[model samples]
Target: MKQITKAVIPAAGLGTRFLPAIKACPKEMLPIVDKPTIQYIIEDSGIKDILIISGHNKRSIEDHFDRNPELELNLEEHGKADLLEQVKAIADINIHYIRQKEPKGLGHAILCAKSFVGDEPFAVLLGDDVVYNDENPCLKQLIDVYNTYGGSVLGCQTVPQEKVSSYGIVASEATAAERIFKVNDMVEKPAVDEAPSRLAVLGRYVITPEIFSILERTEPGRGGEIQLTDALKVLAKQQNMYAYDFIGRRYDVGDKQGYLEATVEYALRREDLKDNFLEYLKKVVK
Candidate 1:
């Protein structure tokens, strides 16, 4: 099997929920504390050869990862050595981008990366969801499962019954190994009562190249856009697809409430900000 080295990040969403905040800025560029949310997704993926699938008004995502010589020089002139290193490190890795001409669905965004992905099994990390695990990054967990099983693996986490309608729900049969399931079926945004299971497919995916063919033939579903879930269902029928309940705390940073929670929780995790932030939070609550 090919080693999972390449990753595709779909950042083309219009982010209608963010409205004015995202009017001129890409939602993926929204900073959680100091780093862009997409940066967190990139780092979490543990893959340096990344191809970001971007769309209109998303040039900032590219600029964020590109070298800023003028800014670096200014930082040097100001004697901000530590800060300079951080800024430089952001552009130190190999990152590339391809624009998805239209605001197509996530499936189309991923389909744009076919040439970049070639024949290798690549991981897909959506900027909307950021999974945190210091010991094992979420994408790494999925890749490990893919390596072990020699097939596609989806990163899954259990969601509340009420929340099942918001995610692609999976029905699976348990494997002998813990937290791994042979996915039998998946329904995209099913009604609460009709959901097959609460095992929601999260943003992390380790998909084989065969999916590209499946996606190409998949007709647009739901909102008249090619749905990845639709293609995944077809893929599941043809191949051995497994879902692994990855160990991590997932934040749906795409949603307003989830975004705020991620920001606060992430701030608390920082050694330099935790004490002051926590004290401020305590004061505000009272």
Candidate 2:
């Protein structure tokens, strides 16, 4: 397998859901706990070179990765050197930012990174989907399958039948543990009767560069925007595509309810807030 050294994170959406909060801040910069949602995706991917595709209103998202000398000094003065080191490490990762001139769609945002990705296979991570894994990193698991299979890999997870229409469903034969599958076909937001399989694409993918050509030729679909799934469908016809039932709990921060759930769940896991937060939750529920 070729060394997968680059990752593309598409954060160009207008984030109209969180209006006022997102008016000045990018949704990807929204805090899950102490860390921004995008940071979690970046850390989880473990890739050093990241191309962050942003929009006109999302410059703060890029600045977050840059050095903040004053913030570091404040942390050090408070005897929080550990926290200071964490802030310093943000600059250690190579982050490249490019603007999506228009609010086209996910496909357009990804197309903006074509130059940065060049001819190499790259990983695409949707900033809204936060995957939690206690063992292996979700992206690494997909990369492993890509190495063995030498094709595109989409990270998938089983969802209830009723929720199939909200995702890109995959039909595949189980080839290993619940974590892997040999995909036969992909259907975007298929109805229950038309659904391929329960394995839903969960916003993580390792795709070959061949996808660029397919995406370029793809016309606007639903919402009058180019759909990435459509491009993947075309690519699947010409090359092998596998879906790995990645072992992780994914939180869709794109929705209001899911965003709140992720914030509460992640906050409860933090040592700084766990004890008091759990106690407060118990009292409230009682």
Candidate 3:
């Protein structure tokens, strides 16, 4: 199989959870400290060609990545070489966008990328997920499994059993590697009492092209919208889908609490701030 060189990021949601704060802003553009969540995802995506599915109020995403010679000139004239280079770097990233036009669902957003994807296997990265891993990027891990198994691979993590209902759960037999599993079944947001296991699907995936056909037939499920989970369920039945328990800390930026945790944890990880931030946090807790 060819290396998956393309990625699709769905950022078209209305972000009602954040309400007025995100009223005119794209949630994907929300900053984690100095960087936007989407930038973090793409920075490590290992993909050169990226297609972002955007919806209402998503113009900022385009502007952020677009080259601004005026701003660059300003930063350069001010002797801010570091800042000037940073803006230039953002401009160099190969990312394109398509309008979703409506807040349908993840499945719908992905479908809009069919033309961009063509017949190649591509990655689906939700902007809400921010995973930190240097040695083995989360998406690279999934792609490794895809190359080995010749099937779709979903990024998964062990969530609390009680939180199983909040995510898609997987049932599988353990492989030689403890974290790799040969997935037998998957249920989207199954009730705790009905969940197959505590293994919850995270927002990263390297999917085969066949998924487009399955998604086309998948009906509106949970929110009266086409769901990626529903299509994956059918794909699971027809093909070999594996869930690799990826090694990384995943933050759900779509939730207020998760977003704050990502911000603090990420900021704490920076070398210059760790000591000071640690002292500040200690004082706040006290």
Candidate 4:
């Protein structure tokens, strides 16, 4: 099993959903609570080097990770040592940024990191999806499965039948106690009748270098975009592919409701906000 040292994060999307707010700020920079969404993914993965593929208007995302000495000094001088340390730690992780010249799609954004990832197996984490797992870090779990199986691993979860068409559905055979399945087929946003299974691919992925070639050859699919799901389907034909039902609560922040839900859930988890927020929720519900 190769040590998956590098990870790719595609943050180049235009994020038209939260237009006004995203006009000046990248969606990936949106805060879950006190930390930006991308920071959560980075901290969760615990990987050393992360390649963030951004677009023209996303330079602020890169700058957010860079050292902010003046801000840190101000925080420290204000007797906010904890906040200062927290901000300073953003620079601790090794991060590299690459620009996606065009909004081709997820696959294209990933292609921008080819040189950074080289020929080694790397992890791809969608910046918009946040997985809240208490038992194990979602990415780390997928990496462990990749180490044991030495193949592509996708993070998946069981969704209701009505929602199958909204995700990349997988047809798989049970292979482990942890809900890890050997994937036989995958379908992207298939209609209810066409879906392979109820298990939908989530945001986490551990893919081999072979995907780069497949992605290059894959034609644009839905929405005139080079869908990563299309490339994965091709890769599955050549090599073994597996899906792990990652243990976590995933928040799809791309949608308005999901974003609000994530904010409330994350805020409620914080010690400072938990009790009061829960009490407020009780009052509001009553």
Tens digits of per-residue lDDT, candidate 3, 74-126, equal 99999999989899999898998999988778898998999999899999998
| Candidates' RMSD to native | 0.8, 1.5, 1.2, 1.3
Model 1, 1-286: lDDT tens digits are 9999999998888999999999999999999999999999988777889998888899898888999999999999999999999999899879998999987698998899999999999999888898889998888888888989978999999999999999999999999999999998999999999999999998989999999999899898989999999999999999999999999899999999999999999999999999999999999999
Report every candidate's CA lDDT.
Answer: 0.92, 0.89, 0.90, 0.90
> Candidate 3: where is the Cα deviation over 4 Å?
none
**Pairs of colliding residues, candidate 1:** none
lDDT of 4 by residue, 1-286 (tens): 6799999999988889999999999999889878888898898988989999888788888888999988988998899988888888888889998888888999888878889988899999998789998678999899989988889999999999999998999989998556789988888999998898999998899999999988888788899999999899888889999999988899998888888999999999899999998999999999
Model 1 quality (TM-score): 0.98
Clashes of 2: 0
The candidate maximizing lDDT is: 1
Candidate 2: regions farther than 4 A off:
176-178
Candidate 1 positional error at 193, Å: 0.8
**TM-score for each predicted model, relative to the true structure:** 0.98, 0.95, 0.97, 0.96
Task: Point out the higher-scoring one by lDDT: 1 or 4.
Answer: 1
In model 3, state the lDDT of residue 199. Answer: 92
Q: After aligning candidate 1 to the native by TM-score, how far in Å is the CA of 84 from where it should be?
A: 0.9
